[model samples]
Target: MKGLKVADINKAAGLRLHRRGGEAPAKASQQQPAALSKPGAAATASKNKNKENAASAKPGNNSKAVRLPAVKAKPAVVDVPPAAAAVPATGNAADRCTESLKKKYSEVGDVDNESEDCRDCLLVSAYVKDIFTYLQQLEISAAAVRPDFLQSPSRLQITPRMRTILCDWLVQVHQRFTLLPESLYLTYHIIDAFMSSDAGASVKKSEFQLIGVSAMLLASKYEEIYPPNVADFVYITDQAFTAAEIRATEQRLLKQLNFFLGYPLPIHFLRRYSKVAAATPAVHEAAKYLAELARADYSAAHLPPSGLAAGAFCLARELLPSREGACGGSGWTDALEVFSGYSRQQLEPLVRQIAGLAVRAGDNAKYTAIRKKYSSSSGSMVSTWPELDGTGEALRSAAGLS
Candidate 1:
């Protein structure tokens, strides 16, 4: 998985940009290094290929070439607060042990009894939320210092239909991972957020796929305790992308964001908050539902992924176990209440909407017809896993995305 090279992705993007700039084919070849001078290279030359396609397909006159402004890199520790300071933690050693025992006992009774996992899962959710809140505050400050750093487009420049198609494609790629729904959401948020600013025009639509892939790679490591290896990442895609290409793209994405890999996500914060509150099983379930829902929709992409996540946790607690009965529980609920503006009533509908989407997420046959149009090729650039068809089904059968 560590196989991707930064220079190659820069070269790839540079090559595409040069082609768009009308550099002659022969001259372009001369500019490339020996590594790309192979006889068959022309067949996969992204720059020239896009140039020809863009010329023949669209006759637009936007002669003013746009340069991507250099963005200031985020600090090594921008969004993360020292773990010691982020939360007023409760539960000394014994209480934690007790909770762990309870969860373990529940699990032994039935793995499918999600009610048991809720305690542990909510703990994980709280960590995700803490990180997210820290990230959100840091992201805001970072953007204030350098407005272009995290700016991006509100929507993909492509047609509305294309946007839907793009999301469908994302679902296919996500299937290959192991319990990385949060990672998928993070990847989507990063690309969508980064493109919101002027930096977007510098990137081509084809480049978007690579960005998504790289973000997923980074997110997997951050979220999953045991992430798939580079080979697994490549393997999961079923060879749609060569290991070399995926590796290269991963590096490029890192460079583009200046390696803000540690930026927090919402899942982290939610788990922590839930625990301190001693949330009931149902409230914890509702929080998980909100996080998953927030991840699947693009509109949710605009909010700092963490803020939306924290809000979800807050909302879930309010809705579940009856808000009136939750007062004496834990400090977690009180703390979350202060941070998230939403009340239980406000989030109920959104929660339902997300629940519906989660159920439908695995219903691939409905979107199969639309997805086929974009998945037309099996070249080194595109992933070709046949298992792509069963991803949604597998997700449904595996813990129901909660």
Candidate 2:
């Protein structure tokens, strides 16, 4: 919004020009001619002054300055494709509730702090990307939106053992009756987002399916999606998770979360603002990283997905690799201006928790059993449970396929 100043540019160019009260334009000629007439004035001038005089006094010394056309530089506008639209924009009360939830997190203020630029956040975002990449491993394409299938399977060929790990983890997530399927899907989304961002972690073939499932478990309850069916979960794991065991772990997870399941996250708000602002490519990426980091933190048993997303993005503007190039530009600036009412301060604690979770998730070994199971179960088909027949709309809606 600031106007360009010609004087500032001139100063930077280091040209000494008399625009102010340095010397009157005619003062030098007036005094010099009179002074030079005096005997002392002739000798008083230095050799450099004589040279200047000689140069100025030359017959053909002066030449008109050539002027060229001044072309104004215009700002470039980047056209970015919108995030995949949700199944139908038509709103029911439940959809309205989800929208409200998005609004809640949208209110968090962004943090200007760049103090904690580190690999962990990048690693976490990359980790989330890998999970989504792993979804390609599922290789199950529903008839609807196959082309728009935003998630891709793993590029690095995974071992059969690793395959079992993923499936078993999925079962494990399903087994956690306390969590919802929507959260599980969200968890996968976060993992994919993270993994896709980080090249190394995805290449290392780190076992992230377990972490992904755990994070999903955390997200489901928060989103109020389909709660996991404990008995069905046990069946998926072949009774590996007893009712008592699942309940105990759920309790532990709840305690770890300080019993707060209702926290708003980054994805909901990011998508909303991104849509309204038509954010640039860079801010879109920053939002992606923030969203995944937020999701990863949910698995820590410490924070909720919504809280983490809010905090991460609040810090994201400061932390992303392109933060400087991305922030305060038309992209981010426009988004912020429109969504200025939103703040990131409310999510700081969650961001810290997510950063911590990113560290812990990297080292956690709870996925050993789940990974082993996932790898081994590929040849055998997972049993399809009977669903009461319904319209495609209802079915699609239930599976979030709508």
Candidate 3:
């Protein structure tokens, strides 16, 4: 971790102070410093000035001049919460992977070249491929966690339609809280896991919504930077589920999941595949809409996250008019096949399923939350496209998938 530098916060005469050479810059006294006309003049001047300056500038130096907290500042009235527990100084596996991504991208080619924009971010992490590899392994177990609860004769209280309704309502709660994308996906996974497990046997028909709200609260705490409080969650439920009920159910749900919160989401796979195609912003958003739209679908629950991601990306490419020559003007290409590890033929079925969901999104009032949410300006209104009415050949082909 990098320590805060006092020099960064305390500027002297709109000029940076030098903690070196036992003297300030001759230009420091000047109201306006002379402009450097020559290339590397700043570097040349910095080298000639002082060695002590470099030592002071380095993070964690013992110099009092460099310590940020040592300097005094005015205080303000603010509600101070209790001190949080000590955060680990060392990086976790995810942290380590992100740190590695901060390195420069040195590979050649248009695909690699385009990704230079996201260099030094987790989007282009070096370990991204390996991370997804582990996620793929992890998803196998997660898939089994959600049994055929819809088809199970033993679970009579919850119906497939009820699951869809709960998911739709949860989407509204998710947007209301402005939670992360993972929280929405994880919430659904928790709901599915709990609904299918032995814990689901005790659920009454009236308690289904309670379970949805509680699962989302648990997911928000796990994924959000600052999750909403239990009171906020209760308020979102119209006070139907009290804070006590939500907290208690959260505890039960966590135990039922055996504390395993991580699930391989379709969005995770779509990111990698989107990079491969060099997909446009509209296309990427459309893919996300499709993938998220699938969450309301109980049938897609049995499908792999990667397939859903790949299919969504492929279908998005078809739905939106292409401005670039992505994938050689084809929906699927050799690079896509190599990266996604799925063939065009393999994606056809899932593409049809996703397309039907999109086509019926508006007409189906039961699933209107997703469509209406996407139709908003914040989502770029991808759902409002007239093409989704099924008049477009792309949508029709995707729907038929013959």
Candidate 4:
């Protein structure tokens, strides 16, 4: 929800620029009193010259000078083309948007410098507010048409473990492409949306991988600046799926969802609330680990993205050392509740589920990809932190669990 409304915000900002451009001519006209004064002065001078010429003609005996009429230069009309007039204003607006994006991406966490910190906070807040409104509308529309997994015909053949395996594979694909985190979450959403639809009811087990890959491809196209080609996906899967098949599946998936791909994802909320909490890199990494774990678990499909993000953040904070100068005050839960729109009681169940998934991921061999992925240095090795295992009881207690 936080990042979903970027398009709408951008449109509004552009409109504001156009409106300012339209007003520029009016302001310039108001400042041109000299134009009006120049015309009056010219008329007065012309009248005096005409009178003198007439007097000279009447009294002149041998004066043969021809009196030429003084023609006032018509006021120069400088016509400004609409396109040219709007160019500078549009450029200025674009520059501001670009700067905002640079600032948004440059700072991953809290800023220590006072002025720079405040600027970053304002940029992020404005961005999130716009996105939140857009996401609310999307949620309302998506809910009306959302498929019911419980009654889905595909649920008969597709087991939860199968879904986990497909999702785990998707995680690997996502990393390979270096896609945005939102892409992976949207990929899962697409897969789930398709599975719960009538079209996916008759899909064969052999074709499951095809569905997963197609979903990822579509999500990439939607969220990525440059999405990978169908061949790339086929190659990634070792040619288990051909390009033609992938394209066809893409069309099917699109038709099923009515081409509405923008859904509020957990990553969107996680990034916002993490900033609100002023979480450290380690806390963020740990939280991401938990969130991804939840992604791979089929049971988490029913949980709202915001709740899942809050749960992951709560667990992440419990797993890491507290920051000395965190801005969220002494009560991290309160900050999270306010920023994430979920109370502690509402977040407790989700937190418990996420924590349970974290614990199980460490113990289960089948779920090794996520654990191993996070164990690498690139992930900050947050998965291997001792506090993850050591703080189980504390985390449970904090979540209001027995």
**What lDDT is obtained when candidate 1 is compared to the true structure?**
0.47
Model with the higher lDDT, candidate 2 or 4: 4
Q: Show model 4 residue runs off by greater than 4 Å.
A: 1-124, 143-155, 323-331, 389-402
Tens digit per residue, CA lDDT, model 1, 154-205: 4344333343455555555554232355776666655655555455556665
Predicted model with the maximum lDDT: 3
Residue lDDT tens for model 4, 153-190 = 43457677777777776776666566678888888888
lDDT by residue for model 2 (70-129), tens: 999999542211111121112222432244334443453221111232245753432332
TM-score of each: 0.46, 0.28, 0.69, 0.66
**TM match of model 3 to true structure:** 0.69
The TM-score obtained by model 2 is 0.28
lDDT of each: 0.47, 0.37, 0.68, 0.64
Compared with the true structure, what per-residue lDDT tens digits does model 3 show for residues 10-112?
Answer: 2211232212124444675547877879979889888867786877778798766544567678795321111001111122234222212222111222343
| Ordered list by TM-score, greatest first | 3, 4, 1, 2
Say what the RMSD of model 1 is: 25.5
| Model 3, C-alpha of 303: deviation from truth (Å) | 1.7
Model 3: ten consecutive residues of lowest lDDT: 80-89
